[model samples]
Target: MTKDTRKTEYGNESISSLKGADRVRLRPGVIFGSDGLDGCQHSFFEILSNSIDEAREGHGNVIEVTRFTDHSIMVQDWGRGLPVDYNTKEERYNWELVYCELYAGGKYQNNSGENYEYSLGLNGLGACATQYSSEYFDVTVFRDGYKYRLHFEKGENIGGLSKEKCKYEQTSTIQKWKPDIQVFTDISIPLEYFQTVLKKQAVVNAGLRFILKDEESGETFVYCYENGIVDYIKEITREDGFTEIQFYETSTKGRDREDKPEYKVKMQIAFCFNNHTNLLEYYHNSSFLEYGGAPDKAVKNALVYEIDKCIKNRGKYNKDEAKITFADIEDSLILVVNSFSTVTSYENQTKKSITNRFIQEAMTDFLKQQLEIYFIENKIESDKIVEQILVNKRSRETAEKTRINIKKKLSGSVDISNRVKKFVDCRTKDLLKREIYI
Candidate 1:
């Protein structure tokens, strides 16, 4: 065999090929699903997700985001900071390894109840990829009476992780970086967009303080909620006339894994029908699900099922009109669903969808039970809702009948002599210039 062919056969382009940082640097889209401003904004989310993960794990309660005049962004959190120990094999600080290496994090095996059960940075590429895609990244960690700092430029360590003795008592982490425009099309963080993201995070976290400041304008905004998603729903639907806000929350035991305790799935949902608009927002493990997934479908199913039951129990609809479609129920529906599970399977690296079917079934059953009880207890409100459903059905039927009548009139037998007279009397027969009414 030829030398090149023998080398190819022996796997010459294997482990000795490309490094992780190089791979990530070349393909920023793989980490964020875009290489434009949207992906650059996602890098901020990747870093912010770390802070939220800490809060989710019962660590700190305060997170601060600052936009500097130098076009740089910094995120600071009062959580357990990154470790500063030295790795004997790599001969580098643990914090350095976190940024300089890929697939290295404390989330590999759930840490046997010591670490987070549900988090956004489970893939171990959050901070590393952020660093690899940035022109300059700096991290500071203060833990246990010591302060550590690590700085990097384009994924290369500038001065390495440095440690110093300090009298600090609280553990904290600060990450600041500038996005590489060559790698990303734009990194300008939209203040309003980020405000919405942080607001949603605060609503989910409940009592976790999120402070955002613009250094240039001196404008600051703080977001913190004590009642969680319920408060969020009320605030959003305050202007609209809502019937009632239905809330259902539960924690169910999931199947056990090898040597791990039974996984627990925590879910909370709030939905209401207002007289104004329809909105549905879903989240999993503190990450927003823009495209929606099984859980969303489950909620929709439960809603339709419960409404149909209500209609039947009230004797409002006959056998022919018993069916209630999603469009009918979705009008003026405002819903917020939050779910967390130790074991969750998202569709892709973007984590925009939850692909687990078990979640759907569980959510459907849970909501169905809650709604059944609610309907039984709140008969008056239930009757009013069913009335609205019937009204929607009538309106739809009337519209359909009108449309059919119009179609029949247009398709019915016509007089050819009358048509010919109309066309001939027309001043212009040019389709573009002529106007006709039938």
Candidate 2:
């Protein structure tokens, strides 16, 4: 349907008609992506991603994702399990809503939301889509001193959940389940994909250790990045050899004169340079907002201002023709950005890319002020970086001229650059396609 075709204002008739399971189909595209194997993997992403969020919350430090020969995928997390409550008045477990209903999660309403305040689950259909998309699905949660199981097939419920002996201690629940073959069109579960995803999560999330054990295949893989995004910076920049892996980390908590203690921010920036051409850069949290957002606008201005002062002080650039490019600043440069908060949305993961501040100008300001201090104090590194920046400037100028010449040859004016939105980039934007492409 064209964007103009759908009614702008629809009634809630279908909304109520949608049984919890049926609700999943009206927007199955919203959950599964394109009704393909990749979408099946996304079903796994939702569960596994939630576990990763648990790790981010400091409730636990391990995540386990296992794929069996039957193409049945099971993610066992060492983190806290889902809430399994026996509604005394209702006489049934709330797992039905937790698993099959949309917007029925602890993350909703921010009640006891100390952990998942920044959760992607707040998107609200985590288990809702899991059940509708799977032919056979079972959720085993160990929480609040109980082990509970909720089973489903296709989109229909089979009845009430059964309480079982908890395998996990009161602290953490052990789990294992099979995503039925009928619903998951893809029969092949690649070990590399699992490894890569888990590794990325380990590096991005930092201290968590995720383990994978396939009983049928009798294979096991473990991933835990002690250094977190710092190691991730190394992995990406390994292509280039960086000199001096200087790192600094500091966390701030409590009210910022706003009298709200829950507002917390953790920052980590690591700077290094390598031999390769590209400045390998990775950012988590709000630092990435500088990628052309309001925050980026602020930071770009501040960065240029700060660097210009430094250059003038050092008396490095006497020519007005010289220019400073982010690329130049990043030449052979490796920078890592890490931020955390109790209230934030990472676009789709627990990465915390956006904050309640809405306008991330403050994040940019924080980065610029702190980095300026860092560059000033570490002049040896600053000099090295400045030299690298000059080289980058020369290269960028050359590339710009080359591009302009190429464009001029083709047409008087050419599209400077083309960028696709995150939604469009993913094969299926129907489901939450906000995933790490790499």
Candidate 3:
């Protein structure tokens, strides 16, 4: 074909769209919700999630995070080093292909027989996106007496992969990166944010040791939780007036049909009610569900249902007064719900919310069964909860009466001004003061 014919194309002034690395560079917000400090922080979480996944799979017991004086972050894990064998299809090392290419990871399997049955990272764009969003990214892997290293500058490879004889005995993977200044103008991660995330990860992956170190200050914080979410709840509500936290966990198995593959669900729930409100944290496969979608609603429904059942059995209220409003239930409650399934679905690429119907159903059923059993087994603790509920109901009633009385007294005392009703006096151009009375 002639040179002129080789480049023929027709469109109404069409332009080529960015691809892969370019797209990620231009649209970091698309991958990480924000291209600011929050997104920079999330990039670290995305990289850290891989190490946490290894811990979840029972391959690794320690994950360490370090913040350097130069504002670079490093995450190291003692898992089997990332696959480094040559790939004929990609004509490159597997580790190189996995990082340089977008949507090229092992967590995309949707079938039951897949290796990643319950994964913390849902999307295929895991570390690759983080690499693209970083100004300098390096990956070092040590495995089977071989050490491999790769480096990239602003998503472009600096050189070919290098391999050498490993000096370390244990297999490990270390990833260190500095965020791109052009993308996130200010990429400083808050120390408290790192602590909160690392602590939560340690709580989720019970036996895993999560370490956070400050290279400048030479200070380190180590988090390891044997009891996981149960301990997390206890620590968060330590200062509040609360009953002993109730904990429940169950695993169930079933298949959609006889011909279909079997699926398993494991759920853990720990909750405590106190006199002060606290945020509820939920995790599906170790990913935080910030939006609290369907599964959160299901858990809340189950709590109200079980609590109401306890009240009715004790004859605390008649049929009309039996209903427990959400306000009453939510006023001072702290809860943590974790669900893991062989097959899970998130609402979006960010994985901020989980949206599987089966998860909702399974969690609701699990909570109701376990909570009822708990109430039956611990009658003394159950009675304390019941008393708290009654107290909440009385307080709500008294507050409502006081509000109405105050409103009535105010209305009876204040002179009704036509300007206030029409909002006319407030619209005036005031030189010194303008007050409208109703």
The CA lDDT of each predicted structure is 0.83, 0.62, 0.82
Q: Give lDDT tens digits, candidate 3, residues 228-342.
A: 9988888888878467788888888755446756677788888887877566888888888899776798888888899888998998874676477666777767889877877
TM-score, model 1 to reference: 0.86
Report the backbone clash tally of model 3.
0
Model 1 per-residue lDDT tens digits across residues 370-432: 989988998887777777777777787789899999988976755564656755455766879
For model 2, how does the per-residue alpha-carbon lDDT over 16-121 read when each residue is reduced to its tens digit? 5556565554545456664555666666667776676676677878777777777777777767677666666546567766666666656754424544743445
- Return the lDDT, model 3, position 311: 91
Worst 10 residues of 2 by lDDT: 286-295
- The residue-level lDDT of candidate 2 at 84 comes to 64
Model 1: residues with Cα > 4 Å off, grouped in runs: 1-17, 88-92, 256-262, 400-438
Off by over 4 Å in 2: 1-18, 32-34, 88-92, 109-120, 143-146, 165-189, 214-218, 235-243, 250-262, 277-305, 345-359, 402-438
Q: Which candidate would rank higher by TM-score, 1 or 3?
A: 3
Please give the lDDT score at residue 116 for candidate 3: 68
| All candidates: TM-score | 0.86, 0.74, 0.87
Which RMSD values do the candidates have, in order? 6.8, 13.2, 6.9
Tell me the lDDT of candidate 1: 0.83
